[model samples]
Target: MNQLGSIIFLIAIFLFSTFLNWYVFQAVKTLTFGLEGERMKQIVAVSYWLIFGGISIWLVITFLRIFQMGEINVQTQTALNVFLTVMVTQLVCVVFLFGEDIVRNVQAGVTYLVNGSNGFSFPERMRWVSGIALVVAMIPFSSFIYGVTKGKHNFKVHREIIYFDDLPDAFDGFTITQISDIHSGSFTNYDAVQKGIDLAIDQKSDLFVFTGDLVNHKAEEIDPMLDQFKKIKAPYGQFSILGNHDYGDYVSWSTKEAKEANFLKLKNQHKKLGYRLLLDENVVIEKDGQTIQLLGVENWGLGFKAKGDLEKALANTAASDFKILLSHDPSHWDEEVKKNMNKVHLTLSGHTHGMQFGIETPIIRWSPVQYRYPNWAGLAEENGRYLYVNRGFGFHAFSGRVGIWPEITVIELRKTVSSME
Candidate 1:
């Protein structure tokens, strides 16, 4: 953005933060009215300014970096995310306090109008409302703090059993461990990341697949941690496909050759990590004289790069073959895979990363990403075709995973029995 645009954006942020801070201060004062000395008051004052001021500084730095380099660095982005989370949580608290103010004001207004000036009495602020608002806000505040400090690498194994009548007999009990959107560029701890890889290896799944986004936008980002990820192995082999970030579309390049070189290096990085980087191609895996097709495509989505050619990948493949496709974006399945002439038994994807934040429970699952992509996370089926959207193995801009913990997906393919048929 130009200087004028940047300045206007920053001003808007400042004004919003100012208003939010005012509401927060009122809530805090009301809650702490008869409590301890000015100590609590001073602390709240310092904290509010420290957070908002730090955010403003971070925003300025971010825009400066963008102006200079045409992109924000990962560290700055992470810092911004932290501040933004805190800001949002504070806003949530203020909203409740604001609601309380409205109710109290309405009650006071009614008393004045009903009794007239002679009998009218001013209503006192209810401290309990502010207290409750604070308590409620602290829940998310604490959750986000935990998410940033530790939950990013809290790898959870999601075990799923999928049954298919047409599944090849040899692959009936086959297990596939999948991880997606590694985004190594955003990773800071090798040992923590290694723990996740170890967990995947421990599953000893027959096959391993990385759906996409091995790095944020550059191949070199994975250089430091290549050895750590290389430890992940499966009996069938490790296969990977590029995600949107793997193409270096977000960063500025000096020349076309430089961009091409970066892409080549990313492809080579997959090879270095011992992954068969499939580009719109199919590989047949045989077990006990029976075969299943593993088809992979480049990142394809409704609005993303349409590099994946399903027809080219499925070329020469039998229609009756049990096919498992590795696609980066779940939208690919929503838009094309399900509608394809040939049946794709299962499709694996990992582009959403569940927005790195959301609530997921047995009773209900929700994420902001759902608004954009219907198949945002977990498993969904339509027309007998299955799509498993991995929550992602690593975080991106937020540098944290809240309720949607990073996942190592273990899928067991079961063949439908004759009795069931």
Candidate 2:
């Protein structure tokens, strides 16, 4: 954005946050009105402002740094996460407080109408209402804290069995391990990340495929944990495809050549990690005299990068061959892959990360991202084609995961058995 626009946006955010702080402060004051000593109340008021003021200052500085740098550093990202967590918790408290205020005003108006000769005064704020608001706010505050501390690296293996009518006989029961959106720049705990890599290795699938976003902005971000990721190997070989973030589009570079150079380095990082990076290309995987086609395209998504060429990836491949495609964004499947005449049997993607927060259980599955991307996570089918979107292996802008933890997917491809047989 331009300078003026940036300034306006910052000013808007500052005003909104200050308003929230003031409302929350009022609730705090109401709750502490009956404190035993004047000094104790003074301390409470001072402590509340100090915390909020410190966070406000930190947010302004970090936002300025991000605007200047065109990218957020790990420290700044963590601080932003903290800011969001606290803000959201405060908003929850505001909801209850606002409700109580509305009721109080209504009661005062009723009293004025009933006794026309005497004026009605606004009632005192109830300590119990403020207490309830504070108590309820703790729920989300605790969840956000846990998400940052542990849930980000809490890798969960999602096992799926996909059946294909035209699957190659020799490839039946084939297991493929998939992970996506590593976002290496956002990682802080090397050992925790290693544990996720180790879990993927433990799956011991026939093939491994990474759907992309290896780094947040620059390829160098992966340097620290390169060795750990390199250990993820499979019998059929490790393959990968690019995601939108892999192209350095989000960062402002001094020159076009610099951006290109960084992208080339990121591509090479895949090779160094023993992955064959496919850019709008296809390869054949043969096993026990039967073969299947593996096609990978560059990042393709609606409203994002459109570098992937499905036609090019399918070039030189037979229409009758069982095809598994690797595309980073799930939107590709919704927009083109499933509708393509090439008849791709399966597609793997992982760009949503389920918004890094949601509730998923045996009875219900829901996330805000669902409204944006219908196939945000797990499996979906259209006609006979299947798409599986991994929930990602690492956190990103938020620096944490809530109900939707990092995921390592193990998919077993099964051939349909004839009922007559």
Candidate 3:
């Protein structure tokens, strides 16, 4: 257990390192690139850093307030702090979503500054111009919190023939809609969730898949929003696999037994929602005398995570068969699927959430999630294999989605005689 805690801390640093690097680069660019492109880049770069850094900083602050404001003992304070931190984070997740507009405006500023630069390299003149523009851009920066609170969730839908393999006659053109990380307690608006679910349902999916982190930390966080989630039903049934959050792995727990008990309870609740919980296991869906093997592993990855054994899950399979894997993290695509595993045609995952913030554009400036996952927010295929990383169905610590709106991915698997050459 101590080893796991150390591992998580290290992974957090590793992931956060990208954010740190991005910000430092922007700060230097803002200081050096006295041109419009540089200035605009500066705004965008700062905005991106602030959004990622701000939430984390706030979470730390919340933890302190929850335990420090009153006269609580060290042990009691620790428990309360963990609970309140998760709760409050769940309550105001929209702030994180709101960072999108800030990114958009900053991206726009990048364009403006690029033109404004006019190629003047005098340090004294450059400082004056950048300082003023940076101040003006702060207007949008300050307003970003408001935009997130204002209840806006925007997204783009990208679907394609990422992986093409032969399917049995019964399941040609089989469409599977998968979504995950619906941290319901954090969402401010239920309607946005409904819209995403509606989009998935529109695909007439044969199977509806949900990777975990359905609620903040407890079932009650989402009890009020079941109506929205319940809307995600399909012909092949809604199936789910757990993520790290689903296992209650984020906090300091009193007893290992209690934590494991909570996980079991959450798993049971999922069953009540009409979902087949696939924990380190596989199930075969038969059609037209052909079998499509669906293998789901527990939350396994390169660190101190849950036990997700893919080989064990697919041990009984014959050498050749149509296969699809459901492992939440895309890292699994690298760690497991791309290795000794069979020619798994299509692998579906959603741990990224795009982190819920994508890239910035003129018409669309959004999240930094793209920089994190190469196969980050959409369908990606390479080397005769494919992976669809769903942006996510719900928000995380912040309630809303900015440029990276929550996603409902409808992936259609078709039999192709022609190779993807």
Candidate 4:
């Protein structure tokens, strides 16, 4: 964006933040009314101003950095994350305050209508309403804190057994572990990241697959985590495919050559991690007198780079073979994989990351990303074909995961017997 556009956007944020500050201040003032010795009042006042003031200062610093450095660096990205989460907490407080006002206004209107006098007094703000707001707002506030401190590293291993009637006999009970969207550029805690990798290694699955997005926009970002991720070994092999971020499309490079060079380095990093990087290619995993095709394509989706050629990737394979596809974006499955002439029995993806936040339980699974990508988060089947979208092993711009923790998926393939047999 131009300098003028940046300034306008910052100004808009300032105005909204200021309005939220006023509501929060008013709420605090009412809550501390007649409290013991004004000590509690002073404490709440100082805490609120300190946090809000810090946010304002951070906004100014990030705005200046954008003009001076021309883009958001790591520091600026972190500051922006803090600003957004705190602002969300303020918004929640505003909603509760508005509800309190509605209640007060309704009571005053009833009094005025019945008495029909100008002397009818406006109802005082409900003291308990402030307490309620504090309790309610704490929900998101604490959640953001936990997400940053722990949720990002809280990797959960999801295991599932899927049965196929046309399965190869030798591949029955074959296990695969998949992780995606590493976004190495966003990592801050090294030991925590290694812990997640170790958990995946502990699964000891037959095959390991990293669906996409090894870094944010630069190849060098994964340099530090290479050794840690290299330890994730499987018996069959470890394979990977590129996501949109691996192409360096989001950053400004000096020249086309430099971007191409960076992309090459990212592809090499996959090899360094002991993974066979697949770019619109196919590999046959052979076992006890049988074979299954594992086809991988480059980043191809509705809004992303359309470099992947599904037909080309499946060239050497036959339609009757049991085929599994490793695609970066779930939209690729929605748009191409399922509808292609060659049937892909299963497809794996991880682009949405479940928005890194959502509630998923046995009874219900919901995330904001569902509105955008119908095949988001977990398993979804269409026309006997299956797609499983991993929640992601790492985070990006948001810096945390709320309800949806980082995920590692372990899948077991089973052969189904025919009912007639």
Q: What lDDT is obtained when candidate 2 is compared to the true structure?
A: 0.93
Could you give candidate 4's per-residue lDDT for residues 51-111 as a string of tens digits?
Answer: 8877877787787775665445578777767876787788888898998789889998999
Candidate 3 per-residue lDDT over residues 215-278, each given as its tens digit: 6565556677766667778777788888867777665567898778878888887877778998
Over 4 Å off, model 4: 2-5, 35-47, 63-73
lDDT tens digits, residues 82-181, model 2? Answer: 8878888999999998999999989888888898647657788999899999999999899889998999989999999999989989998999999999
Stretches of candidate 3 off by over 4 Å are 1-60, 66-132, 135-147, 150-152, 304-306, 360-372, 418-421
Clashing pairs in 4: none
How far off is residue 346 in model 1, in Å? 0.5
TM-score of 1: 0.91
Which numbered prediction scores highest in lDDT against the true structure? Answer: 2
| Cα TM-score of candidate 4 | 0.91
Q: Candidate 1 residues 1-421, lDDT tens each? A: 6789888987887778677777777777787678677898788778877877667677766766766675556767776676667676888898888787788889889988888788677676678888888888888888888888899999999999999989878898999999999999888788899999999999999999999999887889999998989989989999999999999987778999999999999999999999999999999999999999999999898888888899988998988998999999999998899999899999999999999888998898998898999988888998789999999999887888889999999999998778845
Candidates in order have lDDT scores of 0.88, 0.93, 0.63, 0.88
Number of backbone-clashing residue pairs for each candidate, in the order shown: 0, 0, 15, 0
